[model samples]
Target: MRSRRGALSEVYDLLRSEIIAGVFDPGAQLVELVLAEKYGTSRTPIREALRRLEQDGLVERGERGLRVRTRSPEEILEIYEVRIYLEAMAASTAAQRRSDFDLIRIRRAQETMDDTSTDDPAAMAAANRAVHETIWAASHNGTVVDLLTRLNNHLTRYPATTLKTPGRWPEALQEHWAMIDAIEQRDSARAHDLARDHMTKARELRLELYRADPSA
Candidate 1:
């Protein structure tokens, strides 16, 4: 038997995963009764989950009730712009402050990402996130990590498949390695520039996808 908080947490996690995976299409209605039935939970947990999703920016409270948040091309670009600033700051700080152990952890995360096959978007996303988090932790900056975590919550609303395009994964891995190399060398300027460029390129890819499929 699950406790009330446990059930609500489970509901939140499941709904968030579905939203990130594009299982629930953008702007789709998330009716409490229907979600309750689908998850074999009551409306209580479903409502709790939707409220939490709203806070995470994965869902919005509309006149019709709860609906998945939809992003326009412009909005997506804006989000990336914020990410670029935050990630670059983290990279720069990490370069100047990272310990040998921090570098080792970052290298391990990158190697894990490199070993991941391109066939699995979820695995790729998870690996990518791990590498980023490791970099953030190496920075020794709590505020930067908190900001990036919030930004990531919003980013989860976007389709994970956006990272699955041809040649993108290898390019991303290379970029991560370059940032790590800069950090290991204590080249703050290079690390900052590379991190910013990496995010800019990713934003361009996302924009291209949006242009190709306006409905997506």
Candidate 2:
């Protein structure tokens, strides 16, 4: 039999993944009884999982109960604002601490981005995430990585990628290349500035995309 804690963790991961994948629409009610039935578990584990998801900011209290969290355009911008600082810090630390192997992993992620078709924005976005995740790992700061990972979860809850913005892809690719170069040279200050500027541009484009399509 699965341990109680194991069951809770399993349900939490599945629920989080479903939220991230849009299996649960934004604002969809998450009932403990329904979820317990769906996952073939007791309400105890489902309740615990929902609580964990709430703490993760993936779910929130609604009029009736908990539901998947949805952000307004302004809320999304605020998320990017927080991301900007965290990403800069990660870049600076990564530059100072990254080993050659880390550079290799970063380069590999960049190569994946390069190979991704612009016509498929979702693939491009996933590739972009790969590069950023590698940089975070290179930073080797567990606290920063944990915080950024959580922030990233919130960001991904929204549909559409800013890379889909016209003329944004090429510029973002250039910025990623520049960041790689700075990290390779161990230029922490320059890496910090580049990462900050890169995210600032992304945030601007995100606002533009939102304005163009409010549903996004």
Candidate 3:
């Protein structure tokens, strides 16, 4: 039972990573037999892992079988509505409470995002996540961090990075610099406002993308 449980967990993490990375695109079927062969496991463990994923709200039941959940534009907008306020509040807290180490980590993550040369959305997206995670860590509010992290898991279903949207990253990077400056200056209001603007732009871009292809 222990060994089986371990295998189940391993499968769960692997599949979750791929799903988040867009390896399995949104709305893609998670065919058990296919996944079983790919993972070199039987259906039992795959099924168990998928069950856990459903509980995590990463996947849902489809007509034929299990598939990745697809979010409508309105659902996504609702998510960002909550995220904008929560994230901005977190940024405010982080500015007020951040230590030197917190500042260092945030700077490193910002640098990481700015330094990415490859057009690989996954790498940029991961780096972008690091910056926000650093801020959340600095916030010192475990409840907010936990809530944002869970919301983020649902957001990872996006097949592309908002940073990669044409004419977005450069402006977004500039916004990050401003936000960082506000944090470093311990200007909580500025940090909050900048964070809110950043999310509002992101919400617009994501809405455009969804409108372009609602099924995507």
Candidate 4:
């Protein structure tokens, strides 16, 4: 039998992934008993997982009970605004601080992204996330990574991928390549500019999408 702590961790991972993958939509009610039965665990683990998720901001207390977080359009825009600067700083710092091993990891992530099919939006989005994650790691700044990770979780609660926007996949790939090149050259200023531009474009696309469908 899984230990209690192990069961808690397992349940937490499963729930968090499901929440991020849109298996649990924003504002969807999260019932302890229902989740316990679904994951074949006791309510004890499910309860603990819910508590951790609440702390992570993935779930929140609603009028009645716990439900997935639903961000307003203003909130979404605010997150992007903060993310833009943080991303730029991460790229700049990475260019200055990254080791050869960090470069290899970044290149691997970029290659994985290139290999992902554009038709598979989820895969493409996941790959894109991997590239950014590596860059965050290369920055060697735990605080930036933690802040960005939380902000990203909030963004991913939305179901649609910005990569699915017409003509965006190729554009994003080019931007990633350029940013990688700048980082490789240790050109911190260039990396900052490229990363800022990249995130600005994403913010624009997200705004357009939200304007087109507020519910999305």
lDDT of 4 by residue, 52-115 (tens): 8987878999997999988677877898999999999999999999999999999999999999
lDDT of 1 by residue, 123-150 (tens): 9988999999999999999999988998
Query: How high is each candidate's TM-score?
Result: 0.90, 0.90, 0.86, 0.91
- Model 3 lDDT per residue over 45-148, tens place: 99998998887778999997899887788778888999999999999999999999999999999999999765787788788889999999999999999889
Over 4 Å off, model 4 = none
Model 2 lDDT vs. the true structure? 0.91
Ranking by lDDT: 4, 2, 1, 3
Clashes of 3: 0
The CA root-mean-square deviation of candidate 1, after full C-alpha superposition on the true structure, stands at: 2.0
What is the lDDT of every predicted structure here?
A: 0.90, 0.91, 0.88, 0.92
Candidate 1 Cα deviation (angstroms), residue 201: 0.6
| Candidate 2 RMSD to the real structure | 1.9
C-alpha lDDT of residue 12 in model 1: 93
Q: At residue 66, give the lDDT of candidate 3.
A: 93
Against the true structure, candidate 4 reaches a TM-score of 0.91
The clash count for each model shown is: 0, 0, 0, 0
